[model samples]
Target: MKINPKFFIGLGLLLIIGYFLQDLVLSDSQYIIGVKKKRQEKDDSFRRVNGSPLSQAQRDTFKNLPYYAPDRAYRLDAQYQGFTLRDTLRMATTGPQPEAYLRWGQATFILNKQEYKLTLYRRAFGTDTTLFIPFADRTNGLATYGGGRYLDAAVPAPDDTEITLDFNHAYNPYCAYNNSFVCPLPPAENRLNVEIPAGEKAFHE
Candidate 1:
């Protein structure tokens, strides 16, 4: 799916800012991403020793798998109520609504008479209600290595008017691309029956 011009521009601006202030970020891979990267490196090393070499799939192991792949795309344009935020490149929306929460951000729902659950986590920012939602799907290991995609969205502010949950910016968690990254698994409440073809796809690696 094509990204909106405003969103792209915003991303470019953010990247530029990040680039300009490289030292501002501490040197540390995210927990899940860090673990994933290490795993990928180990796999690559093993492949090298086997003389098979890392293929594109393996190489892609270092790339965070997004949902906006060739097959699917998600749009970040949903407002439940009293929330005004933009879904950025790290948002992953829930699927199969009416599902009960088994736990925090984890629950099950009925889909086509069948039941499925999902695990949703967020890397929140700021002291306010804003959050960074980055997630991967169950397809990550199979069709997409089970590493879902990232859908960055603006969280509803306290007593806010609206919120924007765009799936168009869904991306893969950092762990999808690299094993050195530590990423959160779908909490059983985020799983869906329908293969959400709105975000990044499986990493080739």
Candidate 2:
């Protein structure tokens, strides 16, 4: 019996495609697992750890903080625009006094075919190497915290031109769980017109 050459070619192509599809599925599964593990650790801290934002009573009744399902789409690579002259931005908080932060840079990215930008900041008095991003979106006062959510990124080096912004890790401020804590509201420039459905949802809602 003669084996057709085309049959072997088609079989090889199917095997290659199957291998890639399997790899993609594994990658997605790992991402989702990692996100869930981090979320669970946070919940554990809130429930049993000291200095948690949750009150004793709240912690006793706490099950888990709500969050949107993990999605790769919400993670983006943004164009980083660093400032030559950093300016002080006194961000208003829930309390009377405002918190000071240095306007470090800007991150511009496109979502849903539209362009958006967010100003990044650093603590005015700390030696921290993290970039702070407090932002509000259309989800506020509906599915998520009304006061907004916060994201953190590693400070990009001066020559770095791109940074990753993962909305999946966005979290509610401490003030969202406790009224005594004063949390900085998202600056007006960081208020996005779009809805970000990822990250932690409202503690009360």
Candidate 3:
């Protein structure tokens, strides 16, 4: 009995496709795992470090930082709108001096049928691609810090126009734990009317 050569050729193609599919799935899974590991390491460092924002009393009894369950819904891909004339933004801090920030751009995203816009900022002398997003939501003064939380967005590339806003990575400013640290208050424009239940919660101290 002679086996058809075409049958073997088709089988070879199927095997190749399956192998690549498996590789792709594994690669994605690994990426998610890496994100989780990095987050855990950061939390661990904050809990164990002597110079962490956590108060000494909290650190003594701290096992882990309070955080909402990781929800992908809060992780959004924003449409970046560049500002033609960059304006200076005065941000109030916990201290006497008001920090000056440059308006980098605005990220507009829709969550739960509500359209929200957040102003992204960069330090006057900041040369890096990190955009600071200090925002307050309805959760403030309740579940999260009253001063608000912050999220950092890094441009994936120099020419990249889009960015990822991962609320799961939002953290409280150092002032939330220790008053010695001068934390910039979230500007009124960055305040969102919606409730963002994700990210770090309010500190008890």
Candidate 4:
């Protein structure tokens, strides 16, 4: 019995599509699992008696920190523009004292069809390789920490022009849990007009 050539062709195409669908699902599942594991570790740290950001009283009653569902959409690829002459930026904190940071660079990315830019900072002292981004969005005071959220990136090499900005990993500053911790406020420039609904949510609500 001879099968039609068209039948075999259609079957092969279906198999190929099935394989890609399976791979896509597996990739997404792995990403979500990784996000959850990191969040769990953070929650455990928050519950720790000695080093926790929570007050001793708060730690005693701590259960788990809240988080938004991990979403790949918030993981963005940005064009990075490094500054030739870095300037010192005194970032305001929740407390009266301000902290010093270097205005190291900027990241530009498109979200929801609108382009936005955020300034990245480095510690003023010593050679710090971390790019710190403290930002406020429309989600603040509603779904996330009212003070703002933070994202950290590796300082890209001078020639590197692109980097990933994963808002899925954005987190609340320690001050969100305890006011005693004086966290840096998101500078006016970093305050995004858009809503970022991914990552950690308000501790209270």
Candidate 5:
């Protein structure tokens, strides 16, 4: 479901408290390893407001992806279903140094600074944000991910000002990451007008 940024902050503090209270979180070796590695990614995640760990499937997806290149960035343009949109993507300078804007998918974004509806989809458990719908055009499937491009804006930020429409960070959904992942499909509203040339390139596998 769409877990807001507040939930992540509180959970993060608990993880810290739990770290000191090792007796609480040490359920297995894997969990411990996860905590340590995630700690390194805190500054980026916490600052940008995307404070969640990558799902196991997501991590696996990256393993199959090509190595990231810092020199590259994607510029997305949208114009499908009669709406035109564009974004000059910035790298996901957060938790994970993702070639794309990678996270567990829990960030809220305001489309074109719209005040009424914030999210494009409704989340589960009354969260109204867990679902995502992204569309890809001919170039994406052929040149990028065969399934098209993936993008999600579920993240936290110091303030809303830090957030912007960055096409450079657009990415493929987890389903693109891995076949097992059931990613939220982009709805009609989230479609773009032009081509997005940032974030993760087409899948290798």
Candidate 6:
């Protein structure tokens, strides 16, 4: 049977639309998958490397690290409030010595109608590109680590006021795993009163 030219054109258009629709649906799934993959890789590295914070005994019996269920809502867009006079903050660590970090700025975001702010920081020395955020939520000492979790974000552009905070990517400090390591304690300003049910949970012994 001879097919009409219009039929072929219509079929092509339908195929194109379907392709885009599938892409849109898969984009979110793909992003979540990437997050999970990165976490798994990090866990694998800790277990495999001898220099990792995890003791050999812990690694010997290690199966998998605990994590909260990934929720899209936990990934939020935030407004960056830059500080004019950057303060030098001396952060207490698990060890006797404290690490110095620059008080870069704060990022404000609203969750459940509650406006929350997280103080961002950078290493006092070297070319700092990472925006470090150590935060404690209500989940601490319960579902998550008591000392709190960390979320690293890219430094926002000088003129850019918007940034993304993915709490689902939050991770515990090395001190949570072993006492031999020194991890910076989250500043009081970074603590959240609300329960953050996403990201790494309390480590199993």
Worst 10 residues of 4 by lDDT: 45-54
TM-score of each: 0.41, 0.95, 0.79, 0.93, 0.37, 0.86
**Candidate 1: tens digits of C-alpha lDDT, residues 26-102:** 33224334434544554455345254334455654444333332211132223234223423223322322222211
Q: Write the per-residue lDDT of candidate 5 for residues 51-168, one digit (tens) a residue.
A: 3234544444433343123211222122212112322222321123322211222223333443211122223224434323355544566556755555444333224333233344
**lDDT (C-alpha) at residue 78 in model 1:** 38
Give the C-alpha lDDT of model 6: 0.90
Tens-place lDDT per residue, model 4, 31-126, is 999999998988888887768888888887888988889999899999999999999999999999999999999999999999999999998987
Comparison by TM-score, 4 against 6, better one: 4
Sort order, TM-score high to low: 2, 4, 6, 3, 1, 5
lDDT of 6 at 137: 92
User: Over the stretch 1-205, how does candidate 3's per-residue lDDT look in tens digits?
Assistant: 9999999999999999999999988876775676577678877887876667877677788776678876777889887887778799888998999999988888999899888999999888667568899999999999999989999998445466777899988999988878889999999999999999987898774
Pull out the clashing pairs in model 6.
Answer: none
Model 6 backbone overlap count: 0
Prediction 3 TM-score vs. true: 0.79
Leading candidate by lDDT: 2
Maximum-TM-score candidate: 2
Whose TM-score is higher: candidate 5's or candidate 6's? 6
Estimate the TM-score for candidate 6.
0.86
Clash totals in order: 93, 0, 0, 0, 34, 0
Worst ten-residue run, lDDT, model 5?
A: 75-84
* Model 4 misplaced regions, further than 4 Å: 1-4
Query: Which scores greater on TM-score, model 2 or model 4?
Result: 2
Question: Which TM-score value belongs to model 4?
Answer: 0.93
